[model samples]
Structures are given as C-alpha cells and as structure tokens.
Target: MKIAIVGATGLVGREIIRICEELLPHEATYTLFASSNSAGTKLKVNEKVCEVKELKEENIETYDISLFSAGGERSKKFAKSFLNKGSYVVDNSSAFRMEEEVPLVVYGINEDKISKETKLISNPNCTTMGLVMVLKPLHEKYKLEKIVPTAYQAVSGSGRAAVESLKNEEKLGEELKPNYRDGFYTRPISRNVIPLAGNLTENGYSDEEMKFVNESRKILDIKSLIVEPSNARVGVETGHGVFCSATFQKEVDVKEAIDVLNSFNGVQYWEETLPTPLDAEGSNDVLVGRMRKGLSSNKILNFWSVSDNLLKGAALNAVQIASYIVQND
Candidate 1:
C-alpha cells in the first residue's frame, strides 16, 4: 500500500511524517507533497529519503491514503483530486469541516461518524479538539447547557512563522521592552499575550473563536450548544491550553467529574498539580485539572486542560483517521 503526505515541509506536516513512520504499517510506501517552493526538496519518511513533489494534478498518482495539512484553500483545491483517485483523505484544515456532508472528527470522541463510504475526514481546530475531549463525557453525565472556554493557545498553533516571530522578538530583546511592534503577528509574542488570535469577523468574534463555537456544536451534534469562547496567542511553543466553565442540567459532583475525565480514553485528569502547556508538549493525552464546582452553582463545573496542538490536535488525528479506515476496511 502507498500513502501520501501533503504539506510535508511544514511544521505540522513534518510531524505527520514522523507519526506515519511510527504508527503506520511497515510495508506502506510513502510519498510527500508540497507547494512549488518546497518541491524537489528531500525528506526522510519511513526510513526512505523521498523527494517532496509539487502539489499539482499533473504530478499526482493514486494512493491508499492521503493526509493533508497544507491549508484550507489548498485542501479545497487538491483534496478532491486524491479522493477521485480512490484515496481516503484525512484533512487537517478548515476546508471541508462544517460542510453538511463532511464528517468533522475527533478520534476518541466522534470518530464513529466516519464510515465505509467516507472519502474525506476533517480534523477539528487545535483548541476545540482539546476542549471537547473534556466536554464529551461531562456532557454525557450532565447534559451540557452552556460553555465558556478561554484559551491560551501556543504560537505554534499559528504556524512556523508565528513560532519564528516569538523567537525573533525574544532574540532582538524587543519583547522585554515596553514598546515592541515588529513581528509577523499584530503584537509581539514574547513576554505577551495577544487577544486577537485570528481574523476578525462581522460578529465581533475571530475566525478562530468561531471555529471553536461551530466545530464544537457539530462534533458534539448539538445545534444550539452555547459556546462563549475567548482565544489568545501566548508565547508558549507547543501546547494549547483551555479553561472551561460549563453549566449542565444536573449538578456536578467533583469526585465523579474527576473519575469521568480520568476514565476517558484521550484524557488524563490531574488532582495535585494543575496541568500546564509545558507538560503537554509532545504528549498525546489532553491534560485536565483544576476541577471544581462553579462559584455560583453546583450545576456548573470549571476545569483547565492542555494538549499538544500539533499532535492530538492536527497531524496525529489525521493519521488516526487513516488507521481507523485501514483497520475497519
């Protein structure tokens, strides 16, 4: 069998290559794809040095599975081409997510939504994936009425440019200064927190914030689920952290909530020390802690969670979808 990795030269794309080697079948061959600028570059995948090909229709070939993390626009343009050639496409972009027919999936949560006839699957936004892993089981125990999620997202979630911006600002000693303005982001990422994490929409929310709201509703199958999300880009390098307060129909039991979270497949509930972004780097599990009843009501529960944005959030989830297809096929 053959597999394709699109965006092989990118941040998440390179992680995907590393995971494909670790998780996929030993015999499955690898092909890497990138834009013209990265084309002809070499990357080692599955112990073989492969040339990164240009992502053009003329260069395409049929493969068993294709994993995409290029970007939304590129996925929209090229993903169907892979599907037409009979490859199962697991996309890590906003492209097909929210399409009425497309299945937006989180591996341990709503992955059962994928099926035999499924041609393309979507990985949720990095922060949303971490948020819902905590919410899904809690919702099962106590029907979730509303959610207020405040995110401290790592710069790595934005891309290599954002990460570089953080590093560059720190190196230039601009971040330590009172007034520092030059970076790829609107604000310097070092020694700072930027409230504007994405493009502003007419509704006064960011595209990233809206992704959290809408994607949560879709993944949980709750059309009217209330999600009040506020996101910020933090100086951290890898993990994304979310603090959530949820109101439910049933009163929350602190002990029971901890057990429920710990028992969940992809979640690790912490008791003594609250999990931090530093702890989540390179880990697959979403770390949850600071569980307690909300100040005002027993029906409300507040908790904090952290996860590696690149792994469980993006590349790893895409590869898991491919694994699910392979195992179930």
Candidate 2:
C-alpha cells in the first residue's frame, strides 16, 4: 500500500517510517510531508533517502493512506481535504477525536468501529492509549465505577523541542531564558515537574486530563465513569508510567483481575523480561505490570502501565488502526 505521512520529519513521523521499514515485508512506497519550512528536507527510509514535500490538497489525494501527526491546526485544515479526495486518514491529533463521525480508536479495543465508509480515524492521546490498554479488559471483567490516575509522563511526550530544551538546559545550567518560555510545555520543563499539560478549561481540567476521562468512557462504552486524572511531566526520555487506582462497581476478585490483565490484547507482561523504553520504544504493544488489589478496598485495584509515547502512543496505534480497517473491511 502507498502511504503518505504528514509531518513526516517530526519525532512520531520519523518513528512511523522506521517501524514500517522494520515490520512490513511488502515493498511499500512512503511519501513524507512536512510544512513549508521543512519542505526541502530529506529523511531516510531504509537505506534510501526520500525528500519531504509540502502538503497540498492535490498531492494528498494521490495516496491510499495518509497518517497525520502534525498538530491540530494543520489537521483541522487539511485532513478533510485529503479525505474528500478519497484517502483514508489516520490522525494522531486531538482535533477530530470527539467528533461523532470520527472514530477514536485503540487498535485492539475498538477497532471494529472503523468501516469502509470511515475516512478519518483519530488516535487517542498518549496517556489515554496506555490507560485504556490496561483498563479495557478490566472493565469487561468488572464494571468500573471510578479511576484515579496519576501519571509520571516522560519529557518526550511534550515533543522534540521540549526534549531538546531539557538537554540544552542541562548544558547551559538550569536557568530559564526569557525567549525560551517553554514553547511546548506550561512551566520550566528542565530539572522541574510541570503539574499541567495544555490549557485549563472552564471546568478546571486541562485538555490532557479531560482526554483520559472522555476517551476512556467512549472507548469502553461506559459513560458516567468517574475519572480523576493528574498529569505531570517528568525528566525522563521515553516511556510514560501511570499509577492507577481504580474502583469497580462490585467486589473484584484479585486473582481474576490479574488473570484478565494477563490475557488482554496489546499488553505484554513477562515479569522477568523488562519492558522499558529500550524494549517497547518502537513497538505497538503497551506494557502493563505491577498489578495488585487494594487490601482495604474490595472495589479498588492498583497497577502501573507503561508504553513508548511515540509508537503505541502515536504512530503505531494509527498504523494498527489502519491495518485493522484494511483487514476487517
């Protein structure tokens, strides 16, 4: 299949190219798309070099599949333009997620929502993807009542600039520059933890936190499930960790919950084999372990979940969703 990756020079886009080269046996053609500023740049796929092109409505119509990882503004403007031209778009932005027509998909969770008529598919936020991979199976076993998740998100989740800023701050000392007002983050992201991501809505939740609440409900088909999310940026490089404490509607059997998590799709739990950033860095599966039930609360369960924010969190999930559509439809 011919694929065009919009924002192909960005971190997630680059990883998508690498994954396609590694996993796909078919000789697929890849067209890389970037903004006007990055149009002339060249990115390597396998040993071959492909020049990045500027996205145009006419050019976008040429590919069978288009993966969009550029921010919302670009997606909002050009996503439909590509789709209107008869291309399937698997977007990694929050732009069209809540739209009724667009399916917000995690490949193994709700991939069946995609159909031949579906042109635009939205991939959930990085944290939401990790949370749902662990929550979906558990939700099926015992209905969830509430979830309190506190995340130790890696710096890479912010974007390439934020990761570079952290590296630069380490060499130039931990002093905030007037010009460098945290371009992709809310506060000083070096040697410090930022308690928020995105803007605070009128309801007092940041856009990132609200994604966990709303997307989980939509994916799990469980609205009115109380989700309290506290998102923070840590100084790590890759892999996001979530410490989740969940309350179910009924008394959950501890062994049963563990068995369910062990059997869930998109989750890897080889306790002896460590699934860190080094292992899951470019893979599609979300790694979940350290699961335990709260002794005090019969309804509560505690666990930790982790995944490479660039892959399962963004590009790989988008690709898996596309693969599912192609196979099922």
Candidate 3:
C-alpha cells in the first residue's frame, strides 16, 4: 500500500507520521508533503529519513491513501483532487465535515459508516473526538437526551504557533505581559485559560464549541441530540480534558455506566481512580473517570475524560481510519 501525509511539517502531520510508523510498520510505502515553505525539511518515518515534498495535485495520484492535516482551506482545495484520483482521503480538517455527502467518522464509535464506496472521510475536531468516544457507549445503553460538555483543551490544538506562544510566555515568567494585539491567542495563554476557543459564531458559540454539537451529532448519527458545549483553551501543552454531564432518556445506574465505558473499545474508565491529561499525553486510549450522579436528576450522569489531542484526537484517529480501510480491502 502507498500512503502520503499532507502538511507533513505541521504538528498533527508529524504525529500522523509517528503513528503510521508504529501502526503500519512493515509494508506500506510512505511519502511526506507540505507547503512550499516547509518543503525540503527532513522528517523521519520509523528510522528512515525523508524530505518533505510540496503538496501538488499531480503528486497526489501516486498514493492509494492520503491523510490530510493541513488547514481547512488547503483541504477544500486539494482533497477532492486526491479522491478523484481514486485515493481515499482521511481529512483531519473541518473542511468537508458537515457536507451531506461526506462521512464524518470516529474510528471506534462509527467506523462502520465507512465502506468501500467512501472516498472522502472527515475526522472530528479533537474535542469532539474525545467526547464522542466516551459518549457512544453510554448513549447505547441509555439513550442520550442532552449533553453539557465543558472542555479543558490543550494549546497544541491551536497548532505549532500557539504552542510556541505558550513556551515564549513561560520563558518570560511573571514578567510576561499580554500582547493582545500581537499574539495568535486573544489573551495571554501561559498560566491562564481562555474561555473562548476558535472564533465566535453569530449564535455566540465558538466554532470549536459548535464542533462538539455538530460533529458529535453526525458521528453518533443522532440528529436531534441536544449538546451544549463550553470549549476553553487551557495552559496545558498536550492532552485534552473534558468534563461532561449528560441526561439520559432512561434511568442510569452508575455501576452499569462504568462497566459499559470500561468494556468499550478505545476507551478506559475507572471508578476509584480518575484520569488526568498527564496520563493521556502519549496514550491512544481515551481515559474516563470521576463518574457520579448529577445533583438534580437521577437520569443525569457526569464524568471526566482525557486524551492526547494530537494523537487520539487527530493523527491517530486518521491513521486508524486508514488502517481499517486497508484491512477491509
């Protein structure tokens, strides 16, 4: 099998390569592609060193599958070209996610949505990926009526520029002043949390928050599900932590919910121990804990979940999709 990774020099792109090396280690041939500015930079796939190539339409046809981590605009422009050439595209951008024709997929939750006929697949936002992974099993056991999810997302979700900004702010320590006009973030991110993540929409919800609403609906195939999302940018360097309170249509038993989450694929749930971002940083599994009954309703359930935003949220999910496609083929 031949595969190509677009945006090869970016943060998620690099993770994609690392995962591809670890997962599809033996047989697949790999190529790296990035923008002209990043082209010619060297990157490693397993032990072999390869230089990044410029992403172009002509070059896309050479691979059987292409994993795109470039931003939405680039994916909008180039993804179809790859698909037109008969190469399946697993996109990690929000580009075609809500498109009626495109399938928005989470590897374990709804991978069965993928079939031989699927040519273009959209990966959910990092926040949505972790939320839906834990929600799916619970939703199956007791149908979901509503979800209130507040995310403590890592700076890595904003790409390398935001991560650099945090590092620069940390180096300056207490002396660091807010550069509201100059930085990529709206406010100082180091030793701070920004309540708004992504741009605000007309409805007052940030795009990142709405992704939790819309993408979860699509991935879980629940069109009428009520999702209220509060997405925040935390100071952490990696791993996204989400605290969710859910209302189910039926009465929920805490023990039963814990069992369902623990047995579910791609997720780990514990009763006595709780998961933190540090535990999730390099792991593929979404960790869930701190399960308890809601204050007001017996039907309500609350829990905490954490996962590496770059891994399970983006690169690893895309690679897993590609692996499933290959295995089925």
Clashing pairs in 3: none
Candidate 1 backbone collisions, by pair: none
Using lDDT as the measure, name the better of candidate 2 and candidate 3. Answer: 3
Task: Let me know the TM-score candidate 1 reaches against the reference structure.
Answer: 0.97
Which scores higher on TM-score, 2 or 3?
3
Given candidate 1, what's the lDDT at residue 177? 62
TM-score of each model, paired residue for residue? 0.97, 0.91, 0.97
RMSD of 3: 1.3
- Give lDDT tens digits, candidate 3, residues 219-324: 9888999999999998899999999999999999999998999899889986667788889999999999989988999999999999999998999999999988
State residue 228's C-alpha deviation in candidate 2, in Å: 1.2
In the range 1-329, model 1's lDDT, one tens digit per residue, is 89999999999999998888888898899889998999889898867889999999998899999999899988999999999999989999999898988899999888888886878888899999989999999999999889999999999998888888888888876426646777878777788888878889999999999999999999988888999999998888999999999999999999999999889998999888878999999898999998989999999999899999999999888888888888877
Model 2 superposed RMSD (Cα):
2.6
Q: Model 2 clash tally?
A: 0
Q: Which model scores highest in lDDT? A: 1
Error of 2 at 63 (Å): 1.6
Better of 1 and 2 by lDDT: 1
Task: List lDDT for all candidates, in order.
Answer: 0.90, 0.81, 0.89
